[model samples]
Target: MTDARVPDRIAVRGLTAHAHHGVHGFERENGQTFSVDAVLELDTAPAAAGDDLTRTVDYAELAQRLHAVLTGDPVDLLETLCQRLADVCLADPLVEAAEITVHKPEADLGVPFDDVTVTIRRERAP
Candidate 1:
């Protein structure tokens, strides 16, 4: 259950989007801002050596893909959204592993808090 493996990474952080994802009816109807952070584990040596965009992750496209996940579905759990986003990062063959974090800043927790976040890490099965 513990995946502490570390490797070179390409990261996209602090992406905010309004999404309709929650268990409560009010939360789904009203929607809220969700912050996401994605870390892709990959060897950047080739891209760095060649200075080729093709050899690396196109972050703009990745952002759009992640955004689509946020804006597309109405999942009831942040865990589901996190899993989907992790899969998006791992879509690239170059990515060996991924860590995805989703933060619900505007959650209806019935109390004041900074954030309620969910994080998941996935590695390609070897």
Candidate 2:
């Protein structure tokens, strides 16, 4: 629920991309700017101690992977996008949990807001 309760997260914030994710035909036809923030829960002790890139989860590659999933397809809902991103983050062996948020700044909503975002969190299966 809160960052203080989630100590195992490797926060990856400010990931931006272009996607055609919405319920309208125009939205699907014309992509919009989307921002993503992913917090991957993993034990970085090994990597921290060994000082090796391979010893722990690489945030750079993770960002690219999340970007691919976000822009790879046209989803009708932000919830679906968040779920998929969570799934991808949990796919890694070192990841124990993840929280993914997808924000649409230029959404077609008539409301006067900066953006609309969907956030989801999940843990790996035992």
Candidate 3:
């Protein structure tokens, strides 16, 4: 058997949406910006060789779906949100793995910080 190797990546960055995702009541009441970055791992050979849009992931549709997730429901933790995003990325059958990142810039940590983010990676099960 051959070893599994990392696949080629298609990435979307700086996708931002306003949502109520936090433990604090105030946060839920007044939504804040949540930025996301998704990296999809897939074998692009077919798409490239055929020059077929259908052979590859439709990123426009993917972005819309990701936006829907960001605006859909309330979550208490970035980890949960990241998982959801990962699920969306892997929904496309072409994708072998996904890396998701959620950024909460306005988190109420009581200390000065540039930003807060959570990143997670998930792979399709064999």
Residue pairs in candidate 3 whose N, alpha carbon or C atoms collide under 3 angstroms: none
lDDT of 2 by residue, 1-126 (tens): 655544466888989988888899988998889999998888887888889879777889998999999889888999999999999898899998898988888987687888788888898999
Model 2 Cα displacement at 89 (Å)? 0.7
Model 3 off-target regions past 4 Å?
1-5
Candidate 1, residues 1-126, lDDT tens digits: the string is 998755788889999998899999988899999989999998888999999989989999999999999888799999999999999988899999999999998987888899999999999878
The TM-scores, one per candidate, come to 0.93, 0.90, 0.95
Cα error of candidate 2 at position 4, Å: 12
Best by TM-score: 3
TM-score of 2: 0.90
Mark the 10 consecutive residues where model 2 has the least summed lDDT: 1-10
Better of 1 and 2 by TM-score: 1
Cα RMSD, each candidate: 3.5, 3.5, 1.3
Model 1 poorest ten-residue lDDT run: 3-12
Q: Rank the candidates by TM-score, best first.
A: 3, 1, 2
Error of 2 at 8 (Å): 3.0
State how far residue 8 of model 1 sits from its true place (Å): 1.4
Error of 2 at 111 (Å): 2.4
107 Cα displacement, candidate 2 (Å): 1.3
Clash totals for all candidate models: 0, 0, 0
Tell how far residue 60 is off in model 1, in angstroms: 1.0
